[model samples]
Target: MSGTVSDYLLYRLNQWGVRRLYGYPGDGINGILGALGRNSEFQFIQARHEEMAAFMACAHAKFTGEPGVCLATSGPGAIHLLNGLYDAKLDHQPVVAIVGQQKSMGLGGHYQQEVDLPVLFKDVASEYTVMVSHPSAIRHAVDRALRIARAERTVTCIIIPNDVQESPYQRPPQVHGSIHSSVGYSEPRVVPKEQDLRRAAQVLNEGKKVAMLVGAGALNAADEIIEVADLLGAGVAKALLGKAVLPDELPFVTGSIGLLGTKPSWDMMMGCDTLLMVGTSFPYSEFLPPEGLARGVQIDLDGRMLAIRYPMEVPLTGDSQETLRALIPLLKRKEDRSWRDSIEKNVRQWWKVAEGQAMKEANPINPQRVVWELSPKLPDGVILAADSGSAANWFARDLKIRKGMMASLSGNLATMGCGVPYAIGAKFAYPERPVIALVGDGAMQMNGNAELVTVAKYWKEWKDPRFIILVLNNRDLNMVTWEQRVLAGDPKFPASQDLPDFPYARYAESIGLRGIRVDKPEQIARAWDEALSANRPVVLEAYVDPDVPPLPPHITLEQAKHFAEALFKGDEKAAGVVSQSIKAMVEQLKPHKS
Candidate 1:
């Protein structure tokens, strides 16, 4: 369709329905850039850094159900994409990376900007990674990369040497030793066999007290999950990645399960006689029912992920929605309503405790209150992205996700610095929807601040300009600091956990976006309101207290002993920690007034 291999590459990608690309420019990719300039079909989004570009691509794939595409230069640029690619790989999102390379001839001679990119990308893009050594090879390279990425729901890489990119395109001849590829992919319909579904239904039907767990894989099967839960009289627990699989408003749905989970979820897992894990690889075995305590039935698209988290009596390998649809017909509704009623009661009580904890006093603002106020205020169809750290803790435990809204974060990688880039990517994919990013001071300092510039560059083009980034500026790596106390029985190490305070709101203002700062407890509600109503994107910076403990749902005796040890070891914030911890526990005990 064009002159150079670069032009043909873009044309091929366009044929594959890829209209947007996230990347940064470098001389190594000059050829591709030149082609992009001449082609108006592709919208090139320039990220502040290559790493952020990769993160954006991953997020795009996550939010849009398409294979996300990212481009980078050779050597350092390629290296920078690894972390974000790993985030995609670990989370099993489809993403295709197009990276530049040095001239083909100079590669083995220690050329500048040369790196063994194939080997470098081997593990992250283990499904497929190839270098285009010939002009004809570019055709098959682009084709296979995107196809594999989509089919596998994993990362794939294609390396193009500068010279090869500049060379004239060539169609593969219909001869021996030549490969020809085409542009097109349709996901196959996958439903487990009827017998397997019956077996799973039998396991679920036989148990009186059934518990269900869902993860990111179950997102598309929301209606089916609700039907299945209703039929089985099961209490559903969500993995962090699957926070939006079911609305928190469901009375029997226990919010999240893990270190940042709710008490009802822990109780459900502890007490259930049967478990039905649907499309989730919630790795924490401790949070799940102990082995042999409950008979389990697991359903996953990837068979490799089944029976690993818990020993399952039946493993159903198939698409979540289709599999659940088939299983629903075989499932018999449970007659007893007691188990469902208790779960609903606990759900109601947990919300009250969460709100009370949010209202409890802290030095400046309770982090829980920041999300709590925002929860009721979230608009329909709002897309939320949270970074890893204390912000994720609050986002996981406090925020009440509704049916229509979408939310996600770095789940398996648990990587920081993804919030802003992910929000940016979401805004690009769905320009009409409102997007919000929840991040901590540490993540903001790491890379979120720079991404504000990217946001500034593109906000004017969006259909609805209501992008918001809420930075919890606590001047500490709050999550890890608490982890030190709870997990390791060690006091806070200021050297590793302390973070320098920054004027996040002011920085947003300087970059031509609205900025709101909240320090007082009451200011949180108003700040969220103003930010949501503003004409342009706003940064709502809340100076929350780092000492407000992100207490787990059910604290173990070992965890309690460690907390005491950390305090006895002279933790820097021992006094504030003790006061806040006591208030949080006391608040949970008091009856809900509202």
Candidate 2:
């Protein structure tokens, strides 16, 4: 009970069920690092950068649904954690960020490595931000940060001055005696009243066609969602964040929405007369049914998010499961299957088109084929993390999340460089499960590739060293190049968009892990097999075609015109993209001879 404040803080973290702390050690945090060295309950994961530490923490919380913990030093170190912290905050994941500060005497003197962290972190960790100035206040501050992080599902910051961390415990016994941390926020289920349920049910019953749009908040209520979908005869469309909420193979479920979504999802949303938005705050209003076109009923646990995206006639504020259970009985089962059947037909056709796209062979391997091949090969209960950009497009469209598998990306923040760190965190949380990071060449070089060393360092500690990094080595910022062609009628800017090639496989091998490079399409499966079979961390670098366009399910005339303009302007890759698009359209338009 009597130890340095650093010891007390670590003890409280352990008590709160944080077994691993991801961080980069710095001079300002020497006291805490020394305490960590002496402690066995908590393991310190040394990340190459403070940003990766924070990203790993965010990914841990995303995978485990527990408050993830990270640490960093003063000034630049603390600032480095912001992007990752914002990822946790925007995605509504719980995270506790502990930062070290300069000595107490350097408060406003502009000393080295000194920044006013409390004020700086205010916007990001709006839930709670405290600087522990007193040895006696350590327990209370740590407890409050943890509790608020859990309850609010947001980031919390705890700033500790170096001197305070090393200070001996001089507080009275009563201060420590009063502090008790609960497992989590124990709030009663917020189910809607019968009247609200009846009203929501009435709205759904009145419409001839209803579509259900779900998000991550409905993750635990998949069965209930199915029941509601079955009763209302509604086709379900998932937000990108909710891709894993329901199995992609479900007949009535129309994959993801927005630019990354399937044709069926877009069609269903556009055609529905009534929309039942469950546990989602999907920000793109244009992708959703127009305000006047469809009557909406939104159900969300947080009242603040209700009706934030679309116009809702009925807003049901409660837990997704509890509210759905209450409203299910009140909903009238639509006897007509016409609406659902049409959506199913579209879904079926879309999959065929998608498969064709994934299988198309180019001079260099098509990127989609990589995901398509990886999908069936993935073992059950696998954890997959995707980086933003072209890699994410492949993951969103091609990867299938079976019942037991978990997949995550920087959904709300939509940031890059999270893929490797997220995979590392998932591996740490479930060492027995196979973890894979699907990263683009640009993203890998940006910040993800460095984490390979961290994985190498921790490989020996894992029960199963099945951490695989699938690098789509396309040698260009392919997504941005495609966007320029399709959105701005501009050709690829070689200087800005092109990336110098790096030997990712060799890099992995140099770090004492398995590395396989695939240049031909036929070698992709073999490379994946080798990587998966390896007993340690492995990198499978597939050199994909930079010319293949990541086309959306449906293409607009304007987009086509932009591509044509780019082609006319001497963009060498434009002709190939147009040919690909025309081929896909022809396939889609062709009749099923069956």
Candidate 3:
């Protein structure tokens, strides 16, 4: 049988090396669905919701460094993809979204599912988006979407009308007006100019104290970064997206930066005389060296993102790995070891403080302890995904990323309900590796619970069925509650902040997966051990105390004032908040030495 345009679209995707698709089926995509039925080659992962599918696609891109493809029906299905697509856009991952629209003739008549998808997707898929109005258009549309998405490392869209999808496939005619497009893209080796590398090295070489900050863009450049850091005698700080860029075992590698950052990272940024930011546009300018205090040199693929956060003396626009490799020869190894020694000391002290905070007693369970205990238990080559909210705070600060592990979250978009989907996507990419999702109860309720069913359906097929979802089952919007006190000086509004309790572990048990529930602190480690050894996927729910605040590395005067004001304003948990805040603060000084 002659293939339809829908079949041709799948063929084009296969040619582009797309082996799997993450999406939910809908009536509007009936033609594509039929084509999928005919083709048995592609792995179509059916997520419970369209949004989860998009997140899965984004995660696939992040983990595999390939352009993730997602499918959706028009209108609402398309609308649901916005949040996850925005996540990929802000984080700069390549993703291609294929959408099904209403009949072409019905677009202007306000027919059902007739959305102006191009307009709807303009911002998210700003690199390229097109509606295939003709059968010949499908070829160019699919080709362009994949190419543009790969080249730009951004989202691109192709909207196919149902009628056009069902139409007989046609190659573009060999005429002047007809367009021809092809598959396959290879990244170019991009290195900064020799003069630019030397100029940047001169600034770095002249400094007495240097600090290095890296992000997701530096994930592939870890070796180069380590060499540079060693030569400069500098401390390295990781932006959240780059948590796994360098292992925490390095003496000079300070953990995450920004609000959820470690004290060592904050201290290194503040005290450094020179800053070398590689492949990271860490947004918190306040957390960086105060403007003119430190001379900066930044390396980024896009020149536009180079010096927006700090005033870089030299901005090298090139690939992080290639640029650093070139810049290495120009860099002189610093003779002074005092700066490096101080940084290592600080790193050691900060780890102790983290232990103190984690071990501090809470009402039932400390959220920090849950992740801290699991950090050492994490399998080699494990992949981690963390949801937004307090779980992210704990994941960022408590978990120690090893050399081979990979971890990511909704970094720029910081959306909830991404942890489960991202973990699922990671498992799909590397079924042999263990995968874990750290989720807050709010996020678990939002969408994680539903995705558990998806996990239950697919876990048996994975090469190593060791997937774990560790839910911090605190019955409150813990992050926002603390934010209200520390940022807005407002009391926790129970009507908005409080959450209904649900049996997450029991629910997992009901779905034929291992379930572990822990309220006592002593059970945290045992629960993690049991979940990791489980034959099937497991849900480990830790009922943590919401009052144990996720304190910032350094508290500001304004934040302190706000905290006092919130307490004065009759916050119901004022005593607990005050007590916990003091305990966390005291841990900074009384770090439990090993």
In candidate 3, where is summed lDDT lowest over 10 consecutive residues?
A: 585-594
lDDT of prediction 3? 0.93
lDDT of 1: 0.94
Model 1 stretches astray by more than 4 angstroms: 591-594
Candidate 3's residue-wise lDDT over 252-323, tens digit each? Answer: 999999899999999999999999999887999989999899999999998879889988899999999999
lDDT measured at residue 261 in model 1 versus the true structure, 0 to 100: 96
Task: Write candidate 2's Cα lDDT for 239-259 as tens digits.
Answer: 888888998878898888888
Off by over 4 Å in 3: 591-594
lDDT ranking, best first: 1, 3, 2
Scored against the true structure, residue 496 in model 1 reaches a CA lDDT of 96
Each model's lDDT: 0.94, 0.88, 0.93
TM-score of each: 0.99, 0.96, 0.99
Q: Per-residue error at 358 for model 1, in Å?
A: 0.6
- Winner on lDDT between 1 and 2 is 1
Please give the TM-score that candidate 2 achieves against the real structure.
0.96
